[model samples]
Target: MISFEAVAISMQGRTLVRDISLSVMAGEKVVLRGRSGSGKSTLLKAVVGGTPITAGAIRVGSLAVVPENIQRIRQEIAYISQEPGMSRETAAEDLLLPFTFKAHSGKEPTAAQIEAVLDRLLLDPAILRQKSATLSGGEKQRLVIARAILLDKRIFLADEITSALDAESKDAVFSFLLESDHTVLSISHDPEWIGRCSRVFTIENGILREEK
Candidate 1:
């Protein structure tokens, strides 16, 4: 679960969003939409300690999103950016790279686990053999999603995750996200994806409101 209590974000004498009090329950899939630069990204960033909130606070599960809890909060949340920066000699290694880290050691996914998630996301297993740089935008997006799924994150904070995907790929991505077992708060402009979310929110003039 995630909670924002009277949150306000300001940068360089300008306020992006203010008075944001929201509670996303466990297992809820919420989508937020706004014009570019309306601070939707900033809101998600705050959840992972990327951006600082001038007022109020945010909580992930029982942990507060402070310096002391940032690392732990990050472990519980998968913060997927709009365009994930991919850098692996091959797509196969890309999936295996995180496991090399000390923190993620012993968490490497097995072949069966990898194959299952790839199929669920409609990705061809052959793509794993291709050069990571050669994969299309949609493929990269799906690969990133696959990585998150393999990690078994409990919460998701996705930012314009499917912006580069085509209709068919977008449908597949939506299916995986909505059907998965995670608390999700995504930012997207796509009407179809927004309609599938349990709730929709929009921010304007530094205020956040539900799109009832």
Candidate 2:
């Protein structure tokens, strides 16, 4: 489970998320919806320690989202941004990049697991050998999620991941996220995504308000 207690985020002397609080249990699916610049993405980053919180605390089970615990917490959670950031060239390297990190070292998944994940996302198995720069937006998103799942991550922080996907790919991604055991905290405005979530919260003026 994840817990946020009076969390707030500020940047450039301006507040982005203010005094927000929320909790998510295991296997729950949540979506943060708001108009542009409502700090939806910033909130997600705050939870993962990518953005510094000005106040309050965030905890992923027993691990807290503090500077000292950030690295450990990140190892247990997968964050997929709206723009997948695979470096150009060496798609296989990019997919296996996380395994090279100290936290994930010696945990490289088998080739069969990789192939299974790609097929589940409707991606070509040969994509692993292609250059990362050659992948379409939808393909990149799928790849990121596939890598996360293969790592056995139980928590996901997703930011507009389905924005560029076709209908078929979008549905596939949605089903994978919701059907899997991973607990999802996503930032999205897609009607379909919002409808599918078990909980939805609207962010406005840096405050979070649950929507019925």
Candidate 3:
């Protein structure tokens, strides 16, 4: 679950958003929609402590998103972006490379598990051996998602993840994130994606409003 109470994001004297309050319960699929520069991305980034909130608080599950808890919160959330950064020289097989870091050393996924996610995402397991620089944008996005699922994280913060995907790939991603065990908070303007979510919130003129 994610909670934002009276959250405000202000930068360089230009207020991005203010007095925002929202709660996404466990096992729920929610999406945030807004016009360009409406602060939807800012609010989503705050949930993972990537952006600082000027007022109120943001919490993930049982932990507050503070300096002390940021690391733990990040470990629990898979923040997928429109263009996830990947090393040009690395092979796709090294998708789980982050697990090599001290903090995630013991969390690497098994070979069989990696194969399963690849199948579920409709990706060719053989692509795992391809150089990261050679993969298309859609391919990279899917691999990023596969890595997150293999990490066993329950919460997903997706920012226009389907932008580069084809219709079929988009559906695969939608189903993967909307599964019963996962909780999703996505930033998307796609109507199909919006329709698939259980609830919708739109940011307008620096305020957050629910579609209800």
Q: By the TM-score metric, which is better: model 1 or model 3?
A: 1
Cα lDDT tens digits for candidate 2, 14-109: 998888999999999999999898888888887788888989999999888888888778878899887789974777888898888887899898
Candidate with the greatest lDDT versus the true structure: 1
Better of 1 and 2 by lDDT: 1
**Cα displacement (Å) at residue 51, model 1:** 0.5
Candidate 1 lDDT trough over 10 residues, lowest sum? 77-86
| Least accurate 10 contiguous residues by lDDT in model 2 | 82-91
Tell me the spans in candidate 3 whose CA falls farther than 4 Å from its real position.
none
Clashes of each: 0, 0, 0
- TM-score of predicted model 2? 0.94
**Across residues 4-106, which tens digit of lDDT does each residue of candidate 3 receive?**
9899999888899999998999989999999998998888899988888888988898899999998889888888888778874665545877788897789
Give the clashing pairs for model 1: none
